[model samples]
Target: MATPGFPPNTLDDEGCPLWISGLADDDPNHSVHVVRGLEPAAALEALGADPRLIQPCELPERKPDGWRASLPAAALGIEPELGDMTLLAGRVGEWTFVYDDAGATFGDVHVLSAAGRIAATSHFSINADASLTYYADGDELAWINVDDLDLETDPAEMPPELRAAFEAAGSVELDYLEPGEPDFDICMRVVSALAGMPWTLDDLRRIPLLVAPSHC
Candidate 1:
């Protein structure tokens, strides 16, 4: 996907500010809606009130029994069952893993970095205690330490394109595609990679809808 330029603007709607847009639906004509803000509850409520406004679907309440069942195994080149692994979050220049029993045994690791540039890399089945691992620089390999601080909950200081993707995805509700689901993982990867890059809204207009890998 290409980068996004200007930030989104709030439109006036019945004395309140709303983010307005025309989204293509199953019908030939597009459907118009008012996107108020970023809260998940509000978004869901709006969809529930007018089902025709968005698509309907359901996602698992939590991570599934097998990691592969919850994520795209082939896309990341990881096995179905990760015996030991770590899930980390990162920001502009830092990251840290959230240790879990599943993560501790599967030895799988997913890394996201927005340091000088946007990059997403992953590794699997490494030694349980390995502190440093090989990362992907395009097709080549680079190394990075795993002990950096976590940045998942940090404020998203995203570039325009990244921010637009977030807004676009957030505006809809897809049940099988929850926040941490594998499909969402790919979305996050794309946004993180496009963050801080120079691009415009017109550029983002051409990005095709990313499909989730079916063989997870």
Candidate 2:
């Protein structure tokens, strides 16, 4: 019954991006994908979305459901089933932020990384699974299961930057046997490192994003 950093209210001054963690706290199933050098529209397509269905929209005032309900007439009749995947994306400089309501993973990191680099964070609280991943030059540089600190990729093979990101997160010192949920804080730190800047909840809310339903 414990979700560390739930109801995120404070901003971290030390430059750890905790704002992305708020999406996980708000929904049991969610995925936030960041890709460098891609526009919101292209990022959505890279994630397998149909470009014909893409539309400019504000970030959800609440959850995806609320956002869908608030869509304008142009978006009417474009609804997918409740279980179907829908996503919202925006840009921060050269980085594109895509938030998936379905908690889905991308079909191909190679395609996504082709734009530049990819840094993704996801939490599926239902199955107690969470991941923070990084990819560049079409190669997966790091993939960590935050809940257990499991290395899906070989740790020794990770690039120096990925190693540094782990260190910056203080994940190197994490003792999995500890009693409380530390995944939230640790995951965000790694994301911040890969992203190379801080993003806040206010930024997420205020950003102009694009929305689409993914057929993939």
The lDDT for every candidate, in the order shown, is 0.24, 0.57
The worst-scoring run of ten residues by lDDT in candidate 2 lies at 68-77
Candidate 2's TM-score reads: 0.67
Backbone collisions counted per model: 18, 0
Question: In angstroms, how far off is 39's CA in candidate 2?
Answer: 1.6
TM-scores for every candidate against the unseen true structure: 0.20, 0.67
* Candidate number of the best lDDT: 2
Tens-digit lDDT string for candidate 2 (1-216):
122222233334322354554444333455667777778898788788889988877543344453333221123334446666677777777667776656665435556677456555533444656666677867776676665564334345667866665555543223543543344455555555555535566666677768887643
Error at 183, model 1, angstroms: 28
Determine the C-alpha RMSD for candidate 1 after optimal superposition of all C-alphas.
18.5
Model 2 off-target regions past 4 Å?
A: 1-27, 63-82, 115-125, 150-158, 167-185
lDDT of 1 by residue, 90-207 (tens): 1122222111112221112112221222232222122322122222222212232223312242115444443343444332224653443222122222222223212222332233
In candidate 1, what residue range of length 10 has the lowest lDDT sum?
20-29
* lDDT of residue 38 for candidate 2: 74
Model 1 per-residue lDDT at 38: 18
